[model samples]
Target: MIKVKGLTRAYGSFIAVDDISFECRPGTVTGFLGPNGAGKTTTMRVMVGLTPATHGDVTIGGLHYRDIPNPGRHVGVLLDASAQHAGRTGREVLEIGARTMGLPGVRVDEMLDLVSLDGREAKRRVRNYSLGMRQRLGIAHALLGDPSVLILDEPANGLDPAGIRWMRGLLKGYADQGGTVFLSSHLLHEVEQIADEMILIGNGRIVARGTRDELLRDATGGVFTTLVTALDNHQLAEALTERGLVVHQAGEGLRVTAEPVDVGRIAADKQIVLTDLRAGHEGGLEDLFLELTAETQRDVLPNDMSADEVRA
Candidate 1:
């Protein structure tokens, strides 16, 4: 398990991570999420002892990363996929790591094959590998030692759809076999599918952390939005309102604060000539993610719309 309490990292007078506390438990995948400059990378760096924490502590199984013996055998980390020697082949990189970790040279072939890097690809120089291939090589390096815990940042950044699915299954199986996986990524959909728990950070602080369902429940405020559209859209809106359901204009349709079944039945009884009908999420992670982290974002749109406006 990984434990962090009151963790902070500062550079000169600039603070990158601020008093964040969380845990990545054994046998679970914890997704660390945030936008650019939200401190996700900094926190991971601190966890692996690449950057010293200005205050507080982060430990893996009750020991600081620096204190761990032959740390790669205990905690695998891949903060940057391109940090390897560009002139070296993928096989050579893994060979060095395997030797450093005291693993048999045969493990090199095993890892390359496990990550689906064929003999031809393995022999290619790291500089010639595309971003996706580099990512695969990096993951292979992380898993080469078969450590108890894995900490990776942006591991899915350059993967294709199939590659992403492959990675998801690999990590899921690893966790099922009792390994700890703490990874950070900007791929929210992938994270939503793979992560057992999630931590959201903004402006150097942890803003939210929980299972997807738990965060969605709290985000929607115990209600849901139903989208409805018909030949007579205005009439459909009125009928929904008369049924004691809150209705609001949602773009070309209407959004009702009720169940999809209720909307369907009401439309059927009213003979409203339904054109489109669907239930909004119980609470969407994307909406909550945007709402919670909007403050830390630097991008500005002249006509930026809120989640409600976008829903409309």
Candidate 2:
């Protein structure tokens, strides 16, 4: 498990990571989420001892990263995939990692194959490899030692759809085997699909942290947003309003704030002919992330700008 206590990092007076604290437990995937330059990279760097902390400390299994014997065998980290030796072959990169961890050469081939970098791909020099290939190579090396903890930054940045799916399964299986996985990624859907818990950060501070259900529950407002239509629109709208439910006209239908069960019951009671009905939770991870980090957001759609405005 990874425990961070009052972790803070500063360059002179420019504070990058505030007094933040969190834990990445074993047998689960904890997603570190934030906008660009939100101190996620700094936190991960502090975790691996790549950067000295201004205050507090991060530990892996009750010991500092540098204090751990054969740290690679205990914690695997991939801060920058492109940091690999450009002149070295893909296989060579993993070979060096395996050697440092006192692993056999066979482990290099195994990892290369595990990440689908075998044959010609593995033989190619790192400089010749594409961004996606480098990401795969970095992942292979991180897993080369079969470490108990994994720390990755933007692991899915350059992966395609299929590669992303494969990575999801790989981390899930690793966690199932009692390994800890803490990763940062901009792919909200991937994080939503794979993470057992999530930590949201903004402006160098942790704004929110919880399991998906726990966090989404707070964002959902306990109200289901539903779209429904019936044969008699005027009659249905009047009946719904009289029943004390808020309804509004929405593109050939009505957007109502009510549970699907309640809506169906009301329709059945009124003997209305329903043509369509769909219910969904209006807010999700994207919505929550935006809300928490809106002030820190650097890029945004202009309030009065659209395709029409741009063409004018």
Candidate 3:
């Protein structure tokens, strides 16, 4: 439903977004992930024409957002959580959002209810709302137009665990109904739970993009961890080594990286009498994301520090 082709944006001599391309399919929630200053916001701005790209283009339903009539009705954007007027009540803020999109004023109230902000706080001024409340308000505004595409940056910021879960369900439901939802977030655990695919950027370039499973497979080569509990760890290790498999001692159990069935057969052949046999997999999205972005930072930063410093 959304396509970005070689999108590039530069600020003076520094490139805020490098040549990058990706697709957000319908009936799926594609996550936009990057470390700080990785051009996630810049890319989103360019996509919506909020910030002009130096090169390349992005389109929704095959038409540039700028070329579409009432683009607000076709795409709902929640980039800045503090974009609303501080003086406006929550309901009023949503009303303005609805009206701005040429939608009905009732949509404001309906969205407020839809986001579960109905009775108690609708009349309260936005300035009086807590950070979590403001997040909900931002989501309410994004949903006001009932647009088919949603581009949200940090929609879960300041939300409690329950609120985050609700947001996840809401986005999932939207995509399940064939809507396109592109969410940008720094929370790896959250993205791991909800996103069907992920696009990870660093130094303004897309370093990785694929399904979570695909990324794990690509970065880790289908590696699996086998934990073997046996009385003679040395014999089991020798048996596995004789089979040309790598083995390492981990606590009382020997950790072997090999096929699950192969490890079991080796233990049987060696008469290891395994009491506990467990299987594991390598790096999750969090691990792959870290590895990719870390390498990018090391290559891009002015000084040769570490990833933690770049993040700091």
Query: Which candidate has the highest TM-score of all?
Result: 2
Local accuracy of candidate 1 as per-residue lDDT tens digits, 89-195? 99999999999999999999999998999999999999999989999999999999889999999988788989989999999999999999999986678898889
Candidate 2 has a TM-score of 0.84
Q: List model 2 lDDT by residue over 1-312, tens digit each.
A: 999999999998888999999999999999999989889999999898889999998999999999999988888899999999999999888888888889999998889889999789998999999888999999998999899999999999888989999999999999999999999975667897889999998888999999987777778865566788999988888888989999999999988888777888889999999998876554566898889988778877788788787778
Per-residue lDDT of 258 in model 3: 80
Give the runs in model 2 whose Cα sits over 4 Å from its true position. 225-279, 302-307
lDDT of 1: 0.90
- Is candidate 1 or 3 superior in TM-score? 1
Q: Residue by residue across 50-105, what tens digits does model 3's lDDT show?
A: 89989998999899888988877778889987777899899888777777778877
Predictions: Cα RMSD each: 5.5, 4.2, 5.4
Residue 90 of model 2: what lDDT? 95
Of 1 and 3, the candidate ranking higher by lDDT: 1
Residue 43 lDDT in candidate 2: 94
Off by over 4 Å in 3: 226-279, 295-312
C-alpha lDDT of all candidate models, in order: 0.90, 0.89, 0.85
Better of 2 and 3 by TM-score: 2
